[model samples]
Target chain A: MIAALLESFAAAARGLPLTLAIWGAGVATGLALGFVIGAVRFFAPAALSWPLAAVVEAVRGVPFLVQCFLLYFGGPFIGIDLTPIVAGWVALSVYGAAYFSEVFRAGFMAVPPGHLEAARMLGIPRNQAVLRIMLPMMALAVLPSLANLAVILIKETAILSIITVPELTFRVQGVGSATFAFAETTLVLALVYWALVEATAVASRHAERRIARALAA
Target chain B: MSAPILSVRALERRVGDVEILRRIDLDVMPGEAIGVIGPSGSGKSSLLRCIAGLDEVSGGAVMVEGRQTRPGDGAVGMVFQQFNLWPHLTARENVALALKLVRRMPAADAAAKADAALARVGLGALGGRKPAALSGGQQQRVAIARTLAMEPRVLLFDEPTAALDPELTTEVLDVIRDLAAAGTTMLVVSHEMGFIARLSTRVVFLDHGVVVQAAPPAALFGAQAEPRVRSFLQTYLDRVAWARDA
Candidate 1:
């Protein structure tokens, strides 16, 4: 069982690159979309904010698996063809964006209204005020939430295996099916996921410290 | 006299159904310090906000040097009651922001000017410190320095020392006196009667959104004044005396 576990770990290790591919692409795309949507919802007039809020709520209301299946299997029915990897990216990005937008919105709200007004009173243009004052303040306020979202996204890449994206779970499941070492394979998968989360947390801590030091200057 | 450097004409401010300020008209001339004083909820701050262009006036206009302009037009600088120093920035950076943005000064020159501004306010050695690290008075001084760096034609202060205790209030008032003596044009909204008496060339007494009287400190603070104004001043003085004893 020990030898089988070691072999399964090696097989799963090969899938790391693909797993990382989905997580990286998904998080980056989601963050960009999230910032835009979040800013619109938080800062835009009610005429625009209400519709964006509805979209965010709708996305967050559904389960990730249902959303994934809809994109991957539902695509062909709509005359849209997408590879498993492409579908995985789309589902992960959309799911992550719904959650991330809320995180960013809360971050913007945390900044005191007085600070923004003071910036404007000092003749800092609106766009520059948002960029130089609002964004940096929001970033620090939202750092921990952002780090947590990254961890959630990392773990969520496992869902991509359902679409046969050949990520860690898909490959590990393949090894288990062939060798009948279900328990051993499961243990190895758990360890890999744990290590990934730990690494993310460590990296987040380092980033936070660096940001603090930079702001101190 | 030559046209006032800053002018507020028929300024009215309404928030929802409530009128925060109405029919407020005042003019601040060069080398003059106008003190605006009134009891709580009397719309003193709102009037100042209108002049600074911080709040939209439902009616009327604010003219800076004969030009209709908005708040932050590089013509008027304001020091807030809370100081409102950007918490993440050092004292120097706070002072440098408008210089870089409005004056378009190079980074090096802005830093040097920021240093000189800080020095002007007796904060030269504390420029590297953040607001959170400084005392309340020091933070307010930094806010004043930040405004001064803009080299505004008129400075507006909204209860500049309201948030401080007695000791800190003295420190901030001392800075204002220096500016007053230096002939900087200013419009100050303050609750501190002594500070207002010492620094103002003219004192505008406000009550219920109207300018009850605009006169020198001596004429207004003297025994003969409007009944409402006299009563308000008596209450303020009584409160101070009570606070000191308590």
Candidate 2:
């Protein structure tokens, strides 16, 4: 069992780069889309706002695994051929973007009306005010939520194993099946995920404290 | 006297189903310090918001230097009661943001101007600090410095010292008084009767979204007041007198 666990650990570690790449790509795409969606919801006309609202609401209400299955299995029916990695990126991006949209919305809303008024009074253009004053402040307000989303995205990368992506979780499953060492392989996978989340949480806490001190200053 | 720096003619504002301000007509002259005093629900802040172009006037118009005040026109400078300094920015950076973004000043020039504005407010040494690091009064001063850096012809303040302790309130009021001395045209909404008495050239008394009395502070505080004005003064004076003795 010990030897099997060591072999599984090495196999999983080999797939670490792929896991990080998926997380990076998915988060980047999700963040961009989320920002655009959140801004429209906050500032666009009701006609435009309603559609974006529907998209966020529908996506958020469904389970992420179901969304991933739909992207993977449902794509071929629509005449679109997507590899498992592509399907995982699509699913995670959609799922993360919906959650991030709400986070950005709350951050923008937390900004006081007085700040906008002060900017306008100083002759800052409306777009300039949003860029210089509103966006920076909102970014600070939403940092913690963004950090949480990142950690969740990292964990969710494991779900890609269902579609046969050669990620950490998939490697662990493969080694366990080959060696018939289910408990040992599963324990190693669990430890890997635990370390990843713990490191992320510690970094996030440190960044939040630094930002809070900067904001207070 | 020089032409009025700001003019509001029959201004009205409605928020939702309720009318917040009605038929507000006023002329603010250059270098004049005017105090707007009113009860809690009298729309004093809303009136100032209209003047600052923070809110649209439902009816009538506001003309600054003969040009209509439009969104992002950058005519007036405003200081809010909450001292809305950007928390992520240092005092100098907060003050410079308007200059850099609005006035399109060079970075070095904006920084120099921000430093000067901070110095003017007696915050030169603390320009590196952020709003959270500063006390309430210091935050308010940073807000003022941010406004003053814009070089606005007219300044509007909405309840500038409402959230400060007595000592901090005095510190902020001193900055306002100095602005008045520098001949900045100011339209201020404040509940500080003592500051109004000492600094205001004209005092506008508002009640229930209407201007009940527009007079010198002395007339509003003295025996010449209307019965309504007398009652308002009595309540205000009683509070101040008690606060002073205590």
Candidate 3:
């Protein structure tokens, strides 16, 4: 029993790097994409904002599993082909982008249009005003939500195993089946995810403290 | 005689079906403070906003220093009623960051200039505090410092004291009064008639989206004022008196 448990644990641990890679890629790309969409909605005309809004809505309203399957399995219909790993990253990014955009939209809105107008009225360049005044405030407001999304993406990576991405869940499930150490494998899987999430929380908390100190009145 | 430093010709503003301002024309010579006064819904703020490019100009032009200018032409600066300082940054940072970003000043130069601007506004010691830590009056001064550091050719003040109480109003008004005395070349829209009568080089009265009168303080507030202007002033003064007594 002890040997089987150790074997399953090692197998699950082996998938850690791949899991982190997918999660990090999805989050980084999603955050960048989300920021663009959120800002477009805030600064652009209704015509542009409306279409982006629709895309965000559809991505958010649909299940992540369905999105992953449709993109991976249905890609050939549109002359698109991606490896399972790439497909999982893309789906996770889409899912994250949609959710993170909503958080960002609220953050940007909270900064007030007056700040931009004040900057403009003072002859401050538009980009400088946004980069300096608007973005910093928006970043502070959205940090907690963004961190939450980062952790959610970590768990979302486990779903990638369903697409045969050979991530933690896939490897651990294989070990459980072959060695009949289902209970031990499940415990190891849970512990790994817990650790990743706790680490994310700690990092986020640290950043919040740093920023809070800087912003202190 | 010097040509007008700022000119607004046939300015017409329409918001949906309503005409907020109609065919308004005016000019401000250098070293002059033009006070804009009117009843609520009388397009007083709209005129300032139109010049600042905060509001789209439906018709007409705003010419500053012989050039057609919009916002950020490095010609116009406006102090808002709300004192719209970025809440997260220190007062000094608020002033310095704009200088760095817009003027391309180096960090040391920006910080030095920011301190000087703050000192000019009597807020030198409060420079390290954020807007939230400052009083409404101090925040407004910090905002003025931020605008002043930019050194625009024209300043448009949109009821700068409208958001403050009587005591706080006095603190901010003193700073602006000094600015006017120093010949900053600006237009001020305000309800503080006493301050307007005292500080303005000329006063423009707007009614029904039109310039009812634009005259020196002595004329606009004098018995010889236009009938509409006279009646409006009488009513406003009477209301102020009533509020004070009540």
State which candidate has the highest lDDT.
3
Measured against the true chain A, the candidates' chain A TM-scores are 0.95, 0.94, 0.94
Top-TM-score candidate index: 1
lDDT of 2 at B72: 56
Please list the Cα RMSD from the true structure of every candidate, rounded to 1 decimal place: 2.0, 2.2, 3.1
Whose DockQ is higher: candidate 1's or candidate 2's? 2
Model 2 per-residue lDDT at A149: 90
The CA-based lDDT of model 3 is what? 0.89
Q: Give the range of the ten consecutive residues with the poorest summed lDDT in model 1 chain A.
A: A208-217
Ten-residue region with minimum lDDT total, candidate 3 chain B: B65-74
TM-score of 1: 0.94
List the global CA lDDT of all models. Answer: 0.89, 0.88, 0.89
Give the least accurate 10-residue stretch of model 2 chain B, judged by summed lDDT.
B68-77
Tens-digit per-residue lDDT, B41-83, candidate 3: 8999999989887798889898897788878777889899998
- For residues A127-147, write the lDDT of model 3, one tens digit per residue: 878888888888788888988
The deviation in Å at residue A91 for candidate 3 is 2.1
What DockQ does every candidate get? Answer: 0.61, 0.67, 0.58
Docking class of 3: medium
Better of 1 and 2 by lDDT: 1
